[model samples]
Target: MSSMLKASVQIDARGARFGALITAIVFSVALVTQSPALIMWQAAVFAIGAFRGPQFTPYAVIFRSVVKPRLKSNPIFEDVRPPKFAQAVGLVFTIIALIGSLLGSSVVFSVAVAAALAAAFLNFAFNYCLGCQFYLLGVRLVSPRNSKITLEVK
Candidate 1:
């Protein structure tokens, strides 16, 4: 029963893509406008996603309630854990970017935001999740016996 319940709560791949698109747009706007507040907001969103899970994230919620319903086909689902871990990674980057902006360090701020933007772009454009890959790698390193480290849609 527990296993069945777990299988039923799979993460939606389309929703993840929507999240990546939203994140990329936010980061791009922040970079272009040099708006620290935007970066901070993005950081907060990522933090919420990481701590509370993606379903509660603003972009994910929008995707679930607004976007998913409009789609003609069924959404694909994957393990929820990897994307949650990925959100944590995004939070770390955005925090660093926010700190750099607050410190008035343009170099640090640019580099951090650029790196984050690149990752987000990869996810949005190519459907490649750098943070999710990192999570999987960490899981594999720490628990070689666990076969669930790979991020495959079930």
Candidate 2:
């Protein structure tokens, strides 16, 4: 990958890390209220994590911040998919939520809370990004580019 792209990833990941922090704060408050506001804020956080915006925002932030630039320059590391792993986490969490919702288990909500906290913690501390990995492996399976062992970003 180009230096510019690697730099971009770092910047974005840093920003995303901050954003995740904000989301964590918001989530903590919302949990007490069980308010609709929580859902809105959570959606915003996911949006930041999932899409490119006016700024590098969420996903890019994870990419940019979690890994070193020199490491990012390596072809193997450059294509590593954090987003895809995040997606998988979300999907698995959602499935649990769905089942719990169907069964009317209040514990499902609690489980979800734990999962979200884990994800944010993983992002903040370990730099283990699941979202990018999820996008790369789960969503892009049909793409020709993803079919290859090596990814060509350009």
Candidate 1: clashing pairs of residues? none
* Top-scoring candidate (TM-score): 1
Local accuracy of candidate 1 as per-residue lDDT tens digits, 63-115 = 97899989998878777776777788889889888889889997888788888
CA RMSD per model (angstroms) = 7.2, 10.0
Lowest lDDT block of 10, candidate 2: 72-81
Q: Give me the runs in candidate 1 sitting further than 4 Å from their true place.
A: 1-8, 136-154
Each candidate's TM vs. the true structure?
0.80, 0.47
Model 1 residue 111 lDDT? 83
Residue 82 of model 1 has an lDDT of: 66
TM-score, model 2 to reference: 0.47
Off by over 4 Å in 2: 1-11, 53-105, 131-154
TM-score of 1: 0.80
Report lDDT (Cα) of residue 103, candidate 2: 77
